[model samples]
Target: MSQLDAIYQLHPKRYRDKIEEESNYASIENQKQAVLSIGSLGVAICSLIIFLIPYSTTIRGVIAALALPIVYFSFPYIAISVAAERRRKEMERVLPDALLLISTNIKSGTSINRAFLASSREEFGPLEDELRTTAIEISGGKSVQEALDNLRKRVNSGLFQDTLKVLSDAIESGGNTAELLESSAEDIRTSLELREEVKSSIRMYTIFIVMAAVFGAPILFSITVYMAETTTQMWSQTDLSGEASSFASGGSTGLSFEQPDVNTDFLVQFSILALTITNFFASLIISQISNGNMKEGAKYIPFTVSISVGLFLAVKTLLGSFL
Candidate 1:
């Protein structure tokens, strides 16, 4: 057995026999999880090493320390996040081709398996492999319906899931498979085009989001820089050094009886840092919410935090002359 296959066999499933009876996929799930575990750990360690290192109190060290934690923590997240994203995009890219193939074969009056395998042999991109997997499971004594359902779950794209659900319903109801395949394929193509149309229609908002991310903050940053510099300059001009200087005319030295004892430079820098962190998480949280799954974007939080901090610090450093 493959290492991944072996690992999957270790899991104690509540419906092991039922799953085994329905599909062979459950038999190898443990191995897949084992690979994921190892991959996440490996990514985390590599990121830590690359982003963090032996350091002095130099500015590089400060930046490295600030950046390292986010990168380190996000490494594992990257693996999973990228996987989900990849699966989703892959499904979309290959879906049309799969649909076309299935539709054509069904029109030619082939059995579902032959149609699927014939379609599999074509370059349907990522879906080709998935089709091949489904063929394998069907060959392994599982129904084509069971294998396809499992594939849909693994993909988890709402549209794909809906399509698979429709297929399942058709199978249950003993409907016309060819007609269903043609309709589903046409529906998918229509949905994609409609989505593109909607997106193109609202291209303005995308620009606004980009503007908010890039140009909007710099204007505020310039204002903050001006304020911090003005405050620091004003404070520096006050003579706070002479407790008993010649200017202490009445023994109650005027130098320190009124001046605020806070470093405006440090205050502004700290405030900026805090704001950067807050903004990163806020953006990530909102994106996740918009996508209809908060957990989907949870892994990306650290990466967002890291990049935000980097940008924040870079701005601060460029304006460090004010300090």
Candidate 2:
């Protein structure tokens, strides 16, 4: 057997089924193999590059070790999830049009199978391809319900699945399939429009979240750091020697403030940590507002981190130059 088959066998049955359902590829085993191969190669290359960086050996080794597993495991999952999301979005985008076309065909006195076959046009994208396959399956002696069920399984889209269930029921019950298709198409279009309006309405909240996490937090933290550093410097240069002598001679009350032992390095590190965590959740919130899925926020993480950190460093430099 091939390596892909071996890997497929090693995975649990449920996971294999999920991979097959989500992926657009013809073969689940090949998709898994591609994911694994690409992930492993990417991790290996990254680890080597990290090792060659001009850092302490212990620090470099620690980073490499921690990154290896995260990259190896997450890259494949991320790739698969992104691919699935794109496929689902494409299907959702064109589904209403495909439905209307099928409805039109059926209204023009075509059989249900022929309506589906007629609607398999290039303009429908992946939905067209799926319809073509379903038509072929029905032509090859499978029942219409069975072929549609298979189409539902292969597409793995909730909207499409729900439409298929309705279509299947209508077909089995001798209902008006054309009317059902038209109604389903209208509902899907209304849903898509409502989603877009909701997203637009939440744009303000998304902007607020991003500003608070990336700009507001970083600016506040930088100002705090600057104030702390200034206080420490000013205290260090104070005439504390005279205060100590006066306290010894009872010239004044023995109350003298000493320089705070706040480590600037620790403050900088904490600021970075705070910014990262804030931006991470902020991205999640934005995703939830816009897409209703927290996982969709993953793509924003790198952007959030880079922008927040860059702004922080820039603010620090600007403040340092003035101070």
The lDDT of each candidate is 0.62, 0.82
lDDT of 1 by residue, 204-296 (tens): 664564356444554466457666766667877877656446557766535543555566556555555565556565555554434444445
Give the 10-residue window scoring lowest on summed lDDT in candidate 2: 21-30
Candidate 2, 5: how far from true, in Å? 5.3
Query: Which parts of model 2 have CA positions greater than 4 angstroms off?
Result: 3-20, 24-29, 41-68, 251-256
CA lDDT, candidate 1, residue 315: 69
Worst 10 residues of 1 by lDDT: 18-27
State the displacement of the C-alpha of residue 196, model 1, in Å, after optimal TM-score superposition.
Answer: 2.6
Best by TM-score: 2
Candidate 2 residues 1-323, lDDT tens each? 88677865775677566556556533244677766676788798778868666668998889888888787766666667666676778889999999999999999999778888999999877778889889889988999999999988776578889999999999999999989999999999999999999999989888888888889989999999988888888888898878788887886666776767888877887898789888888887888789887766878988998899889988988999987
| Candidate 2, residue 148: lDDT | 93
User: Which residue pairs in candidate 2 have backbone atoms (N, alpha carbon, C) closer than 3 angstroms, thus clashing?
Assistant: none
TM-score of each: 0.65, 0.85
Residue-level error in angstroms, candidate 1, position 88 = 1.6
